[model samples]
Target: MKIKEIQDEIVEEFSHFEDWKEKYEYLIELGNSIELIDKQNKIDSNLIKGCQSKLWLYAELQNDKIIYTADSEAIITKGIAAILLRVFSNQTAKDILNSDIKYIEAIGLKEHLSPTRANGLVSMIRQIKYYALALNTN
Candidate 1:
């Protein structure tokens, strides 16, 4: 699916929950389903710096698409990473770079997160976009 389509699907999924508590539970479930990254890839180079918890993210270009693999020390952070990967992974660098990820606000995620987690989310997005920019230029 296109990035927008995947994001829309996520929005629809989140809309089913009646409250933030339910939404957080769903995020945990999403995090639990994230495919584990290889141990070798979970090194310092991949770690996202601004996050309170350790979040390791890696991206590689395969067949003109950016493939992402990630893991996190925190469950909520992991879930956030998984959601981002679901939308950005296996997509062209151009697509990833152009994506605004508006679904984050649409799903009411930013308002629900603690300030630190929100910063982490912003850092994660910047890192993902950086990866896309680097890959697109190479």
Candidate 2:
């Protein structure tokens, strides 16, 4: 699906939950459902900086699309990365770079998160963009 479409779906999903607790449970579920990153790829180089928890992001280009795989020591952080990957994975580099993930605000994710996790979310986004930028010219 297109990034906007996927994001809208996420917003819709979040709307069903009336409270933060349910949102958090969904985040944990998302995190658990994420495909595991290769153990080898979970190296220092893949670790995103600025996150209080260890978050590793790995990406590669295949058939002109970028594939993202990530794992975080923190469940919420992992879920946050999963949300981003849901929008970005298997997408073209340009699409990933140009897409605006408004679902963050739509779902009030940042406000609901601890300040540290919020910063981690931002770092995760930066890492995804950096990967797209580096791979776009290839």
Candidate 3:
């Protein structure tokens, strides 16, 4: 599915939850669904810059698409990163570049975050996009 479709689905899914706590719980459940990145790929250089918590993202080009794996030290941030990876990973470079991530707010995430976390989200998005660009270049 497209990124917007994925965001819409997330919004639809979380809208049923009454509060941030429930929403956070759902996000954690979602995060748990993703496979862990192997130790070999969890290098420090792939870590996201500007995040208050340590966040690592690794991407590889496979069959002309980018496949991403990410992890974070914080649960909430890890959930956010997992959401992003689900939407962007396994997509073509052009698809990743063209995706509109603003729907994150529509899902009631970024606005609820602290200023630092909000900035970290933006930085994470930029880093993910940069990985897509790098894959395209290669």
Candidate 4:
């Protein structure tokens, strides 16, 4: 799917929950469901610096798409990474760079997160965009 389509799907999924508590529970479920990055990829170079908990993000270009893999010491952060990957992974570098990811706000995620977690989210996005910028071919 296109990035916008995936993001819209996420927004629709989150809309089913009645409250933030339910939303958080769903995020935790998402966190638990994902397979983590390979141990070899969990190097210091991949670690996101601003998060209170450790989050490692890695991206590589494959067939003109940027594939992402990540893990986090915190489940919520992991869930956030999973969501990002779902939207951006296997997409063209240009598509990743062009998508604004407004579903974050549409889903009411930013307001619900603690300040530190919000910063971590921003850092994660920056790192992904950095990868896209570096790998862009068009």
lDDT of each: 0.86, 0.86, 0.78, 0.86
List pairs with backbone clashes in candidate 2: none
- Per-residue accuracy of model 4 over 1-138 as CA lDDT, tens digit each: 999999999999999999989999989898887557889999998899888888898888889999888999889888888888889889999988888978988888875345465438888888899999999998
Clashing pairs in 4: none
lDDT of 1 by residue, 52-108 (tens): 788889988899998988899999988888889999999999988888978988898
Worst 10 residues of 2 by lDDT: 110-119
Tens-digit per-residue lDDT, 6-120, candidate 2: 9999999999998989999999999998877899999999888888788899999899999999999989878888888898999999988999867888987856344454447
Q: Candidates' TM-scores?
A: 0.92, 0.92, 0.89, 0.93
Per-residue accuracy of model 3 over 1-138 as CA lDDT, tens digit each: 877788788778877988889988978876777646668988888887888788788888899988888787777777887788888888889889988877687778866345564436777788888888878854
Stretches > 4 Å off in candidate 3: 112-115
Model 4, TM vs. native: 0.93
Q: Number of clashes in every candidate structure?
A: 0, 0, 0, 0
Local lDDT at 107 for model 1: 91
